[model samples]
Target: MVGAGALIGLAVEFHALGWSSIPGNSCGGRYRPCPEGTTPTLILAFVFTFAGFTGLTVALAAFRRIRPGKALPGALAAAGVLIALWPGWQAHLWLRGPVLDPAWQASPDRPASVRGVGVWALGDGAGTVVRARTDALIAYDSATGDRGWVLRAPARESVCAMSERPVDGIGLVAFARDEEPCDTVWGVEVSSGRTVWERDFAGRTLLYGGGGVLSADGGVAVALGERSVHGYGLTDGAVRWTAKPTAARAEGGDDAECEPVTASSAGGTTRVVVTCGRYTDFHSAWLLTLDDATGKEPSRRELPVESWVNAAAVLSAEPFTLLVQEKDERGLAAVLAYAEPDDPERRPVTIPLTADEEDLALTGLHPVFTARPVFRAQVADGNLIVAAARPGSDDAERVAAYSLDDGRRRWHADLGTPVVALAPAGPGRVAVLGESQRLWTLTTGEGTRVGEEDGTTVRDIAFKIDDGPQLVRAGDGWVIVNADGDTYAPALAVRP
Candidate 1:
């Protein structure tokens, strides 16, 4: 019975340490861990005490039967040894020193309840991207930080949603916004910051979801949703075509919907990747490639169950179609690039994630304790810049950058907090956000802290963006020193 109790105690310790055979599987049960607010230290102490008491009681019983003198001393010594080591172990678990600098540790001036509004900054000091209110868009000059132009929504129409930052197009910044009765998509000239043209869907179901309006190199913009795809001219906002989503139904079963995950257009081809699942079971995924000129889907390929793409980017370097396959129950996720999306015979080049990144992704139960993988691929100069983190560790998580051209590791920066958001700064740089309400800028070429040394460069964030969370380049160089607190103010936007 003493041996059995020792085995049980060993099992409990192993489980708490996350030493299970299955990676990312904690012993606290998958999909559910120990309930919120359950103190691990208290529970561990209780188990160890109980185990020691039981062993001592057994030894006493044996001593009375066999008349052994040494049993009491041995059991007492064992208990003392365990109690002595408890403090050291607890210190190791709890004493991970602070990740923020004392200089940058000031409290946020903005209220905690404020919601982030849409903000985007342009390249080469192009301009400041701003949305003062939910129904209006404003652009400020990079030199002056003064409003360059403002486009207000009609009284009857409200801006329902926004796309990912300002997409650089042919002499224009293409953005999408869905209104009350219609969805409005526009291409505003960057130089003027005024809408060049606007397209609206009167009362039709607006295409909303991943990559709201993506600019194709061939002067086209595409929007994707679960049930439909819409394309428009980048210059005129003229409707090119609307087509049924390219998701197939499960044979002899109920209808399954295709939810658009991410999309891109490269080499005159627009690929919309969609995940097909019924209810909560995401069973399959595929990609639909359309010709830029006609908006006609030239090809459709159903991905293997093992290669369900979760995120995608059409990299400027080599025009590689980068796909992110998230870690699943079976295996760790991989980032792969293909010369062609439809060619099954063509092999793909895999981009590596930081070790234990899968576990970081699985930590979504608590935002502070978990990290969603950051897989943004952007073309700065001529290389594809990708950002990701290994956040399971508490002391500090590592945020890294890799060049897609040669699969070479460029740089990595150890961050004190789990990553909450990531955005491109400028050439060879990316901005990282943490739930601790802090932001840091790191170089892509070598993950060195780019701004002030000694962590003073890190800036305090007021709160996470509500509805539309976005990060953009700020200041003259690569350092993202500030967020647009004016736009994200509590009075300007309502908390959802």
Candidate 2:
């Protein structure tokens, strides 16, 4: 009886994981195909099912040979009867087709003819904010929404690029201006809106992920390209360090490239982690740590990665770890965390997601999970926030927050939509962006949605993928960007 119960429980768990050997539906939904092949759930399910069948067959044979009775035959007959009628009584409800919300019309008060804007809430005591556009870098007073200063870049270069976004620190903002042949990164003063320094790079500059592009101590800003990682001084914008993956160059051949995942500098050490290889072939990731003062490599650690892992990023730099999101062979979406690049212990902690929860998350949202990997991991209120679905029927999806230190679940919010983004709002509060154009205020302490709002809508099918308004923290309030890369301060009033 115990063994049977265990087998049944295992089956139920595998079903909850949403893994299948059904070819294209390994993630097991009608929405989209997962990039992976077979899943661990399917493997375990086959084991359990085969074991149960063997046990039953042996039991029946023993009973027939030793003490043949009607009991064994009657039991088999009853099981067959139940199995035959099980599907007849079951009912399934198909969901409604997703409807497109109205395209967000920017307010007239917003900057007109805006090509692109990078909004940063310079939350220092001065209550100053910065916005970078194609032609100008404008600073604003957060108190009255008054424009402060505008420093325009030279006409030979553009202020923003289609791929890279600007990032801000205490009183400085860093951005990459795409020139004719190469891109240059400029660090400007937020108060005066003056260019402090500029450094040229071989390719596009790196944008900040969960851990911002700047180091923790604000000494160096890290930029990543297809083949190399360039570190620049935060104050002077001088090239501090340049690292190319030795393993990738040695093993990946001419076609393989080194992709820098994430970087952080603390306690006079700057660590940059990069994954090297061709996605269609085998690859590995390595962590490179250097002395910030001299740009010397003191330690290098090779990270263990699955052959299927195509992308990774640093969640928090204090411990210096990487987060990976990919589908397994059976197509089940998986989120995993690895130790610091220097550590050899590569066992990853798998973040859990349920089939029902995934359904809620993908509803009204684009089904391209593999295209957006960094969105899978977030850090809010010192806790790591992961968008995972729990096993349930009523679409009770949750944004689970785990401890940054121990990976223990700290809190979770049962928002109906999948959490697409998490931004720090205020003390103990987080701004959760649902897959749909909805924003909810979640208190990290209790995992409760204390505030909610219908955010910007999208009418065009093209707008449904990739480009969405980003949520930013301005002092104690919020700032949002729309699909057109225009900044709107009106959404700042969102509060629980």
- Maximum-lDDT candidate: 2
For all candidates in order, the CA lDDT equals 0.47, 0.49
lDDT value, residue 142 of candidate 2: 50
Give the per-residue lDDT digits (tens) of candidate 2, residues 1-496: 2344344445444444334223234233322322121254456557766765565566566667876786665566446435533331231001111122222222322445544444555645336545555566666665555667877767645543211223444233334434332255567655576778876677544332222233424476665544676677776777777766556355545745556655656667767766567656656666678676666777777654555443344555555545544324443233345444455555545543334334222221121111111244455555666556666544334677766446567776666665556666567766666554455667776677663233322122122323334555554444443324333332222221
* Model 1's TM-score against the true structure: 0.54
Model 1, CA-based lDDT: 0.47
Model 2, residue 290: what's the lDDT?
67
For candidate 2, the C-alpha RMSD (Å) to the true structure equals 20.9
Q: Write model 1 residue lDDT over 336-436, tens digit each, in one string.
A: 55556667676555555545442212121111100011233454533445444455544224455555555555666666555545677666666665444
Task: For candidate 2, list the clashing residue pairs, or say none.
Answer: 37-329, 37-330, 38-329, 38-330, 39-330, 103-459
Residue 480, model 2, lDDT: 44
Angstrom error at residue 62, model 2 = 99
Worst 10 residues of 2 by lDDT: 91-100
What TM value does model 2 have?
Answer: 0.56
